[model samples]
Target: MVEGDPAAPYTDATRARLEVAFAAYELADLARAAVPIGEHELSPDGTGRSAGATLADAAHVLGAARRFFEAAAVFERMAGADWELVGDTLGVSARAARDRFAVAEVCFREGANGPRGETSWWRAHLAEQPLEAARDLDDWVLRHRDGDGDLGTTPVSGGLVRRVNTGG
Candidate 1:
């Protein structure tokens, strides 16, 4: 019996299949975005698929694609990806995630199976640090403000504000 690394339970073939599926998902996403809201011919040539496709169908397919990608990513993560790979899959910037994990690295003791104490683990895991300290709010605002001095140009939604035109 051939034993595999516990962290990487998936075979190479399985990983390849996952990669293929991820590509298909990306293509499907592109197609979904290219499709318009109203009914239109599937092909410019008359020999292809019929019209009547709705945005809902595209949305459903996109949702499925997202789920498929997530599943593949889960398998990838299980296949011994380090923290860097994990962060990439999770959509977090590599440097930020790595720097955050660096703290845990410092606290990590070799040969230890896990964190020594619950409180210590929680403290290390949940610690948050600002990427940049805003020493002067006025300076920060002026730096970010556009030439017209309108911070109101872009709208903020879902805690994601669009980047303002910092006339640099």
Candidate 2:
């Protein structure tokens, strides 16, 4: 609303946020090793005032991509010490965040499956209605060791699926 400010110009805070997002995104890209960023990097770029925090944000955000698996791998490793951080770091409910974290983890696994970069966040999801389990789908399959090894496989629908432990 300033007189001299351009009409479409972004404010300092907004521009700073954009810069943060861009830097974080670039870092993720460099690390992804040829993976799609999708919309994960859009989260902490607007925030993350700290390096660890930004990296965590990047890990949580870009974790879904195969490249940033290392970044998210770090996050997954931390679960051993503080599992609660998953929710706070990823910005989701305890369960939902855990699910997203697992989503990122699997994306990396499928992308690289090891300590390498490779993933397709979009190809792993479904667009079906009436939300169903992730395992019900056949096209995508992901297993996370969050609690009791939540193993889930996606049907050909390619929507969101949840991990389940059938050994029970």
Candidate 3:
């Protein structure tokens, strides 16, 4: 639904929101498919449905829910939503929401393979660290326009090197 040049660079916020929107669309499609017309009717005695059918529906819905939650968590992080705000939206305690969504946020950032060097560090660190390590790296990449510095040559050690500028 997000129409634009595929090669055009997008800010992390835009990317995260687009991902969430896509995931929501997928979830809606799955929900519709899970209850096809004439197939979801339940009798008073519950005799029309087989155990397999019920289990399959349950699994499908659960999977879709998980994907939606992960996408939402990623979007919230990229939007710089505070844990308390996230918790209120999810009807949970601030600490509980943060604990649940931290891994998803970290995974989304780590999985991002952009031309820029900002997220490259996550890949290396995530590969060597346990998933629990994600909590420690929360908000490591600031999700704002000024967060990522301009790409240019900078001095490293004693010599100038071409790289993403870290506004130091």
Candidate 4:
């Protein structure tokens, strides 16, 4: 009676559940198939809306489903997250997530640089670090404390300074 369709046997609830399964398993898989494998979770999958929902909301579908960390990690990688979806999984405010989004980018870029390239990437990722370091060094030079006070002003703060040699 719903329509002259072949799949009309399914009720609305069934269809909705199917749609959730399709989004998580089918759609997500198709979208990520071409991407190279990496350290992160590639395909986000759930067999039901409750399954498809965030870690915390997953409890509604299955009793053993609330896994906050897993949900956050998956949702975070997504380019955009719907408010309802975020709430279901994270149980956190959409506004909170939006605010943290900017901070997360900083961490993501630094992580991408890998420990081996930390020195070079650190300055680029943190805008304030380079500026502050430059200011301190400049002050040192201007006051004739960097090399030797024989050039200009004498070293007033301290005759010696401690610095780590990062092997630049």
Candidate 5:
């Protein structure tokens, strides 16, 4: 379990990621519809970095954004959304839906990346395993820790659950 609220980390990240994911999806849909994309140097409030500088960058952005969306959707499904409902929404079988979530759980948690964002940097080089066949959660969590020696975690069901030291 996380030090405080188990769902906090995932929920906080979900909102922002969902926005980006939806935007990416919309952009892709528009492009497929032959809608002309007006050129502009779109930067957030005061961010010096431009959103997309090249075709390759845009492609990468869309791909990365979509994965976040897919991962978030999987997390949502895990939170009491039945496999049949997930299957209907994702257009897959119930078993496949569960499998996808299982794979997502492993992808979302296990890895050498310091955290979620860090994984993006080495996505091409890293190969993630399916959750059912992946390493045990406890082993993975023990292997990955933050700079403060604190490991960021999300609540998972039916496995070795660790009680985080709150240091209260």
Candidate 6:
């Protein structure tokens, strides 16, 4: 449980999972903003041209959105969320919801068993520096360059970086 918060009812594990889910939600919001609506004119260099988000850019945003959604689903489940509620929220049947997030759960578990587990890192971050954790998530979402940067180099709080292996 988070310290100095008398109103917080969740255990530490649940809070860590919820933090990850919140981060995923933030990432999803960023991905949504990255989706281009219409064509825009590029700066004139020798020839002025109209350019917008390419098909590949749109596809990458879609893929990132899907991954963020899956992460939210799996983390919420880890935090003791009911499958029926998750299904209702996602507009799917409970079984279908479980099936859809199964891969994410497997990937999370595989990573959790590794030496440098994301789950363990989040837990430690939450326990040691809760406020910094929130700031780190905000920084990550704001500075994230989808498909154009290495995750291992993205700095977070305490001089640590993120390293995601989704097993794709």
**What root-mean-square deviation over C-alphas does model 5 reach?**
14.1
What is the C-alpha lDDT profile of model 4 across 1-168, one tens digit per residue?
A: 122343223322222222222223323333434344443433455233343334443333342121223234333444355644554555777665445443433443343332223332332422334223333433544643445536433222122122323446
**TM-score-superior candidate, 1 or 3:** 3
Which runs in model 4 stand beyond 4 Å of their true positions? 1-71, 74-79, 109-168
Pairs with steric clashes in candidate 6: 1-12
lDDT of 5 at 155: 17
Question: Can you give the lDDT of residue 113 in candidate 3?
Answer: 38
| TM-score head-to-head 2 vs 3, winner | 3
Report how far off residue 83 is in candidate 6 (Å).
2.2
Candidates 2 and 5 compared: the better one by TM-score is 5
Tens digits of per-residue lDDT for model 1, 42-103: 45565336444455566667755654444344444434566677678668876755554443
Best-performing candidate as measured by TM-score: 3
Q: After superposing candidate 1, which stretches have Cα over 4 Å from the reference?
A: 1-53, 93-168
lDDT of 2: 0.37
Output the lDDT of residue 80, model 1: 52
Candidate 2 RMSD computed on C-alpha atoms after optimal superposition onto the true structure: 21.5
How much lDDT does candidate 1 score? 0.40
Superposed by TM-score, candidate 6 places the C-alpha of residue 8 at a distance from the truth, in angstroms, of 18
Order of the predicted models by lDDT, top scorer first: 6, 3, 5, 1, 2, 4
Please identify model 5 stretches exceeding 4 Å from their true place.
1-54, 109-168
Best by lDDT: 6
Summarize candidate 3's per-residue lDDT along 27-51 as a digit string, tens digits: 6666767666354566667665555
Deviation of model 6 at 46, angstroms: 15
Model 5, 49-167: lDDT tens per residue?
Answer: 54444565557657655565565655565455777888888788988877765655555445333233444433222223212211333243444433635443421212222234455
The superposed Cα distance between candidate 1 and the true structure at residue 16, in angstroms, equals 7.6
Off by over 4 Å in 3: 1-8, 37-50, 112-168
